[model samples]
Target: MLPAEFDYAAPASLDEALALLAGGTNIRILAGGQSLLPTLKLRLDRPDLVVDLRKVPELSYIREEDGEIAIGALTTYADLVASDLIDSGVARCLAEAAASVGDLQVRNLGTIGGSLSHADPAADIPAAALALDASLVARSEEGDRTISAGDFFHGLWATALKPSELLREIRFRMPANGGGAYEKLRQAASGFALVGAAAVAEMDGGTIEAMRVALTGVSSGPFRLHALEDRLVGETLSEELVREACDKAGEAIESPLSDAHASAEYRVAMAGVTARRAILRAAGQWR
Candidate 1:
């Protein structure tokens, strides 16, 4: 289906983009357009103007500063996969997730910020960001605010971003002596996750010092299994302990969504399985 007619503007600067957004109530920012274009074509959204961020050169770089990684809003999934500065474990996990997003073409065109802003429950980045304890930087006419990944996602297809605001960058403290992994049950057709898990573990003398486990596709939004993390912290990393952590994670999810690909019960079960696998992989048990 064809989208409704709309005015398009590819702003060369952030201020111009902001001006376009501030000028109208119905304006959509086009980053990667992987998600937005489809929604527009389906007529799920009708915007008076489309503010293309692609030409905003400032929003497309990755840099490391003060022991944290900063990714600009326009950074593509493929860019994240190719960055050598990111930890090997985290990069592998992100690359795997990015590669699974639709296909190579989608990965090359899909922006990290676009995916997060879309807030698709089954998308891998939200869960991965949660596990990494990432923060989002959003800018608007009023000012800028940094929101934790946990608070950034409000619900299914929802986010903390105000209509007038644009997400600038995503920042997170790089882990030390820790590794991470993302595991997902993919839909054969779309390659989107049916149930996905991202796990990060910090080991001190072979004992867990800190741990984070997050899940997607099982709930309305990506969420960290804090209860399970608490149980794992200070415990030795082992198959048995990982199993227990995964079980706790499965039990912690209050509600799981049932979709065409999988039932709620199946998602819950897969969440546990994926969580266990991801944690083990992060812990270097499975390499």
Candidate 2:
């Protein structure tokens, strides 16, 4: 496949990227190029300008500051997986999701920011982000703004990011050490999640005090299962109760996506199955 001819500029700084973005329409921002490059090669898009942010060093960091883990948008999945800053339950869930994307090479090349900005409903990172209640920081010529993970995804292959905005960083509150895990059924060919689930919990003896369950690949976007969390929280779990909550994982979606690899009914059913295993893994109830 051949791409349409387009003007390209690799910006050295965030300010330069912002100026390029604000200056015109049809100017696409390029992060890792894992998604956009494929779109371009397939002739799915024809943009007049491509602003590359690969050289912007400031946008590649993983650190703990304030009350959250500050992750620059350019922080690669490999970086997140290898970072010591990924210590807590929420961060561990994110690391597991990052590790699950593609293979080793893809993890090395794919940026967390790029992955989230692409907003593919099947991608694993979004479920982790949503489960951990992460916030995305965007920079534009106008100013900076923070978007909650719940508000960030507009729909399939869509996000709240405007054309003029560059995703700067992602931050999530540091969860105290407890338990976290991500589980998914992957599409063999693309390695995209057929249905992905992430769970983060704060445990008190045999009880869960705080918990979050999020899912991807089953709907138009990733989402938290608040009702399921409500049912699990503050309860001393029995296998029966955990099994019941996992059955409701599909309830996170208003509508499930049916694609060539999976039917919506199959995905919805897998949603409950996978989430059950994921929650069990997080709670140390199952191996």
Candidate 3:
């Protein structure tokens, strides 16, 4: 399908992109264009202008400084998968999720910032973001502000980013201890998650000290299973216990999606299954 005519600008600098965004009321920012381009072609979105950020070199890097790891918004899924920094320890789940997204071509073209900004309910990245307790940095003419991953995702195809804000970077606190893992059931056709779970856990004296479990593809948005986490913490983790705790995975979801690929009930049930697997894997009790 041919897209509606729109003025386009490829900005080499973020400031120029910000200027374009501020100057236009109906404008779209194009990162990898894996998601936005499809919407444009379908005429689901008819922006007056599109500001391409591909030439913005500063927004495509991965760096670790002090106690934080900062990843540019333009960092692609392929970059994440190939990164030694993301392949193990705390950020492993994020890499796992990135590797699971679509195929080789999609991974090469899909940006972490673009994926999170699009906020697709079935996306693989958001669950990892939630588990990692990531922070998103948004830049605008006003300056930079940070948004926690918990507050960043609003609902289906929605995020906290304002029209004038460009997602600059995603930041994660360096993993002091423990490990994390991502687990998902893919939708056969699109490779989107039927139910995706991410879990990060720190153990003490062979018991669960701290843990985070997050799920996507079953709700209006990806969300942390705090209720379940709270229950499992301080308890010696076991297959039986994790299985029991994860039964509450769907209890916190206000709106579970029901689509042709999977029913709400099926998703809710799989939520428990995936969450349990992720939790056990992260805690090092499962392989």
lDDT of 3: 0.91
Q: Per-residue error at 236 for model 3, in Å?
A: 1.9
Model 1 spans with C-alpha error above 4 angstroms: 87-92
Per-candidate total of colliding backbone pairs: 0, 0, 0
| Tens-place lDDT digits, model 1, residues 1-287 | 99999999999999888888888788899999999999999999999999999999999988889988888999999898888765464545555566568888999999999999999988999988899888999998777899999899999899999999999999877666778888989989988889898888778877988888889888889999898888889998899988876775677777788878998888888888999999888877876
Give the TM-score of each candidate: 0.96, 0.95, 0.97
Arranged by lDDT, best first: 3, 2, 1
After the best TM-score superposition of candidate 1, give how far the Cα of residue 287 lies from its true spot, in angstroms.
3.4
Give the CA lDDT, 0 to 100, for residue 58 in model 1: 95
Poorest 10 consecutive residues of model 2 by lDDT?
A: 84-93
| Model 2: CA > 4 A from native | none
Q: Pick the candidate with the highest TM-score.
A: 3
Candidate 3 residue spans exceeding 4 A from truth: none
- Report the error of model 1 at residue 70, Å: 0.4
Q: Candidate 1 vs candidate 2: which has greater TM-score?
A: 1
